[model samples]
Target: MSLAKQLSTLMIAAVLLGLGARVATHSDLPFWGHWEPIKLVAPPISIADDAMAKPDSAFAKSTSAYEVNLAATMVLHMKRNKSNIHFVDAREDTLYKAGHIPGAMNVSFDHIDKDGDKFLALPKDDLIVIYCDGGDCHLSHDLAEFALAQGYGRLAVFTGGWAEWSKETDLIETGSGAK
Candidate 1:
């Protein structure tokens, strides 16, 4: 082809590419562009030093139990031995009142201070299974940290939480005031 025609084609391609890049970086371009700003948010900081200061540091430091994915089977096991284990729902009272794991007790983190003294009201030795709304919720982490601070050695966070529990058709469920 002619040199003029080739140059014009190249310029057009470059302009189209630039426009596409600009659109991709803009947040107003519908659902696909909404996540652009999230990529610019700050990264996570390390918590090793903060975790080391707790009395229950050994338990809190290790994420093995804290991070485990507890499915419906584990919930069923805990339900069978309800007397030995305590199901602590860490969601807010409103969510708790809406619906929660059957036989679970509400312990809203908003009520507990940073010192975690309020959680001491419960028996320390009980096998505590902490849960929140679901995998995305942070209430379980808040309650587990509080419980650990209060000197509870046996604590397991059911990361799947209410969402996973609700999926089980065989599991029993009651209204908000089951306890």
Candidate 2:
């Protein structure tokens, strides 16, 4: 939401709230409306259609979205160089303590949101690779979104994350700070 829209909403809500504070409303009025999932019917898709729109990995679970970043590329980057790229482990503290990508920093989504400067303290132009528990895990995505909004460029999501990464290699560790 934009600042102006949010301010307008707050003002209108404040007025309604003030009225509520003065008057005794009935209990019959529901505060929230019932919500149901909306069914969407899309036209049938074909390989040619998707290939033209966007090309994903061969093994990728048929998504119409952008391609997933190659975790091997990140692992290779880590193995080869240390300055251009940085890794963030967006998992719980305990899970992070168990094991994480080598030189990965335990900066959970909450941590980044609370003190973005903690991560922003680094060079904004450097590559930031974020990961979580791999499949269906969105913590890294959320953090990446936040970082991008805050003007950090050269961002990549290790979408395969730790699950896919750990299976491929044993370059895991326990701790904070990047190499």
Candidate 3:
């Protein structure tokens, strides 16, 4: 064959081989058939809101500015009363030991759940203030929710928590579970 004709034939063969390889490689796929129509089934919709109207605990909602400020004020009042109010630190021991609100008792979320019934057996009406590491921490919220579920109506969560309280030089610090 002439040089130009040979080159053209070679290119054509290469193109055909490439097309054949693609077709063979893709033939096993379900959607590769010429006339196959694909049908996608949508996932089942969940009606969770209808099944459960509200969260188990009302305190899960974001704390209002007034609530947070009031909680802080209450902590101060509790400090003065000493024997009346119970302040629980929900953060880990390391964080609590570093620095926490004065007289705050360290009762982690893990410990409370183990003996949930006994842990919550205290007077539900007693004033309980729960706090965690800081504004970003949710341990206090979890503790408050646990308390609320156990029929504690006077439970309060100090949203600002240790971070905000630690900023004050004279607020008082028990170095963890002192009180």
* TM-scores of the models, in the order given: 0.54, 0.57, 0.53
What tens-digit string does per-residue lDDT give for candidate 3 at 1-179?
A: 89999999999999999779879888554534566322111121122323112212222322211134333434344443543456778877777788777777777786675535544655664556677866678777777767655566655566667777777545656564553
Per-model RMSD to reference: 13.2, 12.4, 17.5
State how far residue 73 of model 2 sits from its true place (Å): 3.5
Regions of model 2 farther than 4 Å from truth: 1-71, 74-76, 79-83, 176-179
For 16-123, candidate 2 gives per-residue lDDT tens digits of 996686566543444469854221112322334433222222212221212234544343344424345667778777788888887777777866666465677767
Ten residues in sequence with the least summed lDDT for candidate 1: 37-46
Candidate 2 vs candidate 3: which has greater lDDT?
Answer: 2
Best candidate, lDDT: 2
**Cα lDDT listed for each candidate:** 0.59, 0.60, 0.57
TM-score computed on alpha carbons, candidate 1: 0.54
- Give per-residue CA lDDT, model 1, range 1-179, as digits (tens): 99999999999999998788878887354534434321111121123334323314323333223443444225334543643566777877788887876667777787766324435666776556678877678878777775665566656676677887777545545556544
- What ordering of candidates by lDDT runs from best to worst? 2, 1, 3
